[model samples]
Target: MTETSKNLIAEYYALHLGELRAFVAKCTGSPADSEDMVQTIFLRLLQTDKMISAVTLPCLVYSAARNIVADYWRHRKSVERHETYVKSHCDCGTDSGPASVYAPAEIMQLLERGMARLSPKSRRIYTMSVVGGMRVSEISDTLGVAYKSVENRLGAARKEMRRYMSRMLA
Candidate 1:
């Protein structure tokens, strides 16, 4: 940037730092989060050339700060939601615990071998429904097959997995 642009941004920083920090604190409800968000806001502003536009400086700074605050809250909310979900779903031996417990590696190996034994169509449908976590309707749409065909494939895969598990254990 030219010296003129550099001087203009420096002026913006000097004039707005306290107001920005205060605004962030009000929006975020925590001093530390506000401080971090304000830093990010200023950093983003400095990295861009928008500071050179005389008419857009105030709007740009405000918009950037708002976006930063919004993103922080959005991310914070998602993390909190995920934590609650994990806590609610966690089963350490409770009645609501997981129905079956298989290590990921074991499950992967079992799935691989079981799928290998299935017919190609059955394997595709089963993988889409179970491993890929696709809905029956989604699989039907993706494979251009009827829902009944998908259901049959899923049943066959489940039966095959059961037999495969029995053989492995035996």
Candidate 2:
């Protein structure tokens, strides 16, 4: 980078750092993330040879920061949608209304019967995850078992429970 360009960027950074941070923080709702984004914008500006010289520096930086914030929101929304879908499918009790085929009480009975049918290890893992509210990794660590083993046990338990519930509902 040329000395003049470097100096111009430094000047811009000095002049607009606070404004950019405030604007980005407002957009992203996170002061820390906004600070990182502001640094990233300046870094991008420092790397490009001609773009900084071609456009108004403040305008370019603000525009890039806005784009970053927009992308953050878009990515957050996609993750939230995915998490909602996964929770709805993976958890049986997430839905229990008039449209539900089985009443909550019947579902609880089925769950209890199904849990009773699980092997000892599987039952413990399932209870720890679903009832004790422990994460799979935490259960694995607590049980001194491999992470994959805990996951497999949980998966098998869920499948068996689903089958039992389906049969009872039918």
TM-scores for every predicted model: 0.52, 0.52
- TM for candidate 1 is 0.52
Candidate 1 per-residue lDDT over residues 1-170, each given as its tens digit: 56776677678889988898999889988878887777777676677765466676778778988888887788789779966864564454565445444466876887688789899888888888776867787899899999888887898788888779667644
User: Clash number for every model?
Assistant: 0, 0
Candidate 1 lowest-lDDT run of ten: 92-101
Q: What is candidate 2's local distance difference test score?
A: 0.83
Clashing pairs in 1: none
Estimate the Cα RMSD of every predicted model relative to the unseen true structure.
12.3, 12.0
Return the top candidate by lDDT: 2
- Candidate 2 residue-wise lDDT, 15-93, digit = tens: 8789889999998899989888889888878877664563577777778888889877987897799668645654448
